[model samples]
Target: MAKSKVYFTNLRASFGRNLLQKLEKLIKEAGIGNIDFQNKYAAIKIHFGEPGNLAFLRPNYAKVVADVVKELGGKPFLTDCNTLYVGRRKNALDHLDTAYENGFSPFSTGCHVLIGDGLKGTDETLVPIDGDYVKEAKIGAAIMDADVFISLTHFKGHEATGFGGCLKNIGMGCGSRAGKMEMHSSGKPHVNQQLCVGCGSCQKDCAHSAITITDRKASIDHSKCVGCGRCIGRCPVDAVEAASDEANDILNCKIAEYTWAVVKDRPCFHISLVVDVSPNCDCHSENDLPIVPDVGMFASFDPIALDQACADAVNAQPSVPGSILDERERCHHDHFTDTHPDTNWESCLEHGVKLGLGTREYELITIQ
Candidate 1:
């Protein structure tokens, strides 16, 4: 297939053209206006950042996207699925609180912030892809309900995926609890005995009789558990947890399939800012120093290509001194791989191409 166009702009800006202005110019030049967003609900998939994580993109960036959507006569809202982990973003209430705390209020970003899944992480839409690994994808209901989808990602390093780019932002970030469980784990979730208070919420919510309360402690029967991940969302105390045991390559493949399920049959666009460049996901409560210096912004209609371009951009830069990549052995000579040697970021893009998502081959069109 032919190469996709990935538009880019450097961080250098004059008083006449700020970074936000550059972002607006970049996406418009990259063909965001091609999508007919007239009076439609455009869901801007983004990570509001787990509370205390300063590596996430600031609300200013989100406003630029939201403003562009509104200028095109679309109703836009910033959104993210509640994280599966026991953090400030595990539930809708707490998620909103964290979002507002992190400067994502409507007053600031000029758009509402919606937790994609409902109060718990169980509100999902079952999208059937039937890929090699995932039979169906459970995506956040709010995300799938939108008329148009756009990913505004903070391109950064991840412990699992090597780097979390457009594909990871839309795929794993949009998955409901069960969808995330399928991507991250091969086995079912188990109860944390210490955290479990015998509330029976999980037992009551489980469609299968997999959980039992005994001696004020809860345990999961692996044989009986279907891995629906409902219990993980329903647990009042956040005791039920999914294991992160999936291989990196397999995890990347699953993430690609999940991404296919989300953007398929919709008008989707992507934009990733290659700043911060943290060594871990924004889901982590704390972030290490950036492994690479700030690159700039990249946007594309093809998410797979967008991701590939972002990875290439990161690898092209020299590793930052006094950062994690500097401290690691550079056997791979690739920034992402050197930072997280075990991760294979290419698998996601390759599998995405196999699924006819988009080609990894891209021509970077510098917008400056």
Candidate 2:
């Protein structure tokens, strides 16, 4: 396969030309505009950082892309799928509020914010892809409905997948809440007796009538449960939990397959911002010191190649002093692996390559 071009831009800004200017230049250089944007509904997929997390990509960068898309005649909209975990983003209303609170608004980015799944996070489109792990992927309705896909990822570490890069953003991020359940576990969610409030909220939402409350505690009947994962969101206390026995390797591979389902026939453009470099996912409400200095922004026509390039750039830099990486001293070569040892992010990349999402090889073109 030919080497994919990953365009880059540093933090430096000059008087006549600034980093933002270079960002536009970089995207154009990567041939993003070559995709016919005329009258297309372009989905600019991104994670509207959890309420208190400050490590997410700034709306300023999004504005750059949104403006470019409009200039190219595409109707762009900022979007993300609902979270499976109990948080402000579990439902569309709260998710939109959190997004607006976190500075993602039409006024700010020259586009509107869309919750990909739907009002309940259950509205999705199941796309079939013959793969090693997942046979079909449940993608968000809005995401799967887009005419063109553009992933704007905040490259960082993840607890489960070693690192949350372009693939993570596209795969795990694109999945509906139920899709997340499929990727993360095989068993249905069980009510945690200690956290259960017995308010009957879970029972009210359980389509299978598997939940019951007695002695002011909720209980789930596994025999009747359908694993739809609706009760997990209905519980106000986050009393329901998915099984943790699923193998991590399997989960990563499934993530790649799901990502494949999302971008299979779409003209997709990918961009990853290696700033903030947090030790954990943006799903966390809080962000720690960066593991590395603000690297730069990268763009490519290939998601896999863009992710590999971002990981390589991060690994090449020395760990920042006083950062979380400073507290540990092992496996210094792989930054994501150094943070998360058990997860092989490469598994997702290789799987994505085999699925033909993109290549693993790339040429970094700096826009200095």
Candidate 3:
């Protein structure tokens, strides 16, 4: 395959020009206008920073992307799926509240905020992609419903995937509760006996008769359970929990496959801002100091290439003075591996290339 084009622009500003303006110029120059957006429902996938996490991308940047979509005659909405782990964004109600509290309202972003998964994170659309790790991917309903998909990601370090870039943002970020459970764990969920109030809600929701309640507690029969994660959403007390025992390498591969499920047969665009280069995921309630200095913004039609470009750029930068990367013993030459010894982000990119998502080789064009 030919090298894909990834456009880039540094975070330099002058009078009457700012980072938002630069983002607009970068995407347009990267060929965002090539897509037919007229009358289309565009989903701009993004992470509304976890409550108290100050490292997430600002709402003002999202507004620029949404405004551009409107300019091209598309209806845009900011979206993200609920997290598998318990947090401020575990359910739609709490998710929306967090979005608003973090300044991602319809008024602020010039578009409505839609929690990809519905009320309890159970509303999903199963996408069949015969991947080595995943046979069928369960994605949030609202995300799959969009006519056009765009990933606006905050490029940063991740403990599991090494760095959360385009593929990470779209693949892992778009999965519904069950989808995430499938990606993170190789086993089925177990009921928390203490949280189960003898509520047969989980038992009633299981389609495969995999859940059984006895003595006011629920237990899952692994033989019958398909790991669809329905019981996790049905439990009133949030008792059903997925076991995250998958190794980091397998998890990265699964993330790539999930990404393929989302962008298949759709017009998808990707943009990543390598700013606030935090040492961990934005899912954390708090952020550590950036491992590297802010790089800039990148945009591409090919997400795999976009991620490769971003990762390469980040690795080239010097480590921040007092950040985690600075304190670590830099034996591995690679920043991400040195920061997160157990993770191999290249697994996701390699798997993505093999899956025909996009090429890892990219032509980085600087947008002045």
lDDT values for all models: 0.93, 0.88, 0.94
Task: Name model 3 segments beyond 4 Å from true.
Answer: none
Worst window of 10 by summed lDDT in candidate 1: 204-213
Off by over 4 Å in 2: none
What's the distance in Å from true for residue 175, model 2? 0.8
Minimum summed lDDT over a 10-residue window in model 3 is located at 228-237
Number of the top candidate by lDDT? 3
State in Å the error of residue 143, model 3.
1.2
Model 1 residue 9 distance off true place after TM-score fit, in angstroms: 0.5
Candidate 1 lDDT, tens digit per residue, 54-114? 9999999999999999999999999999887889998899999999999999999999999
Ranking by lDDT: 3, 1, 2
Per residue, candidate 3 scores C-alpha lDDT tens digits across 63-171 of 9999999999999999999999888999999999999999999999999999998988888999999999999999999999999999999999999999999999999
Clash pairs, model 1 backbone: none
Q: How far out, in Å, is residue 21 in model 1?
A: 0.8
For every model shown, what is its TM-score relative to the native structure?
0.98, 0.95, 0.98
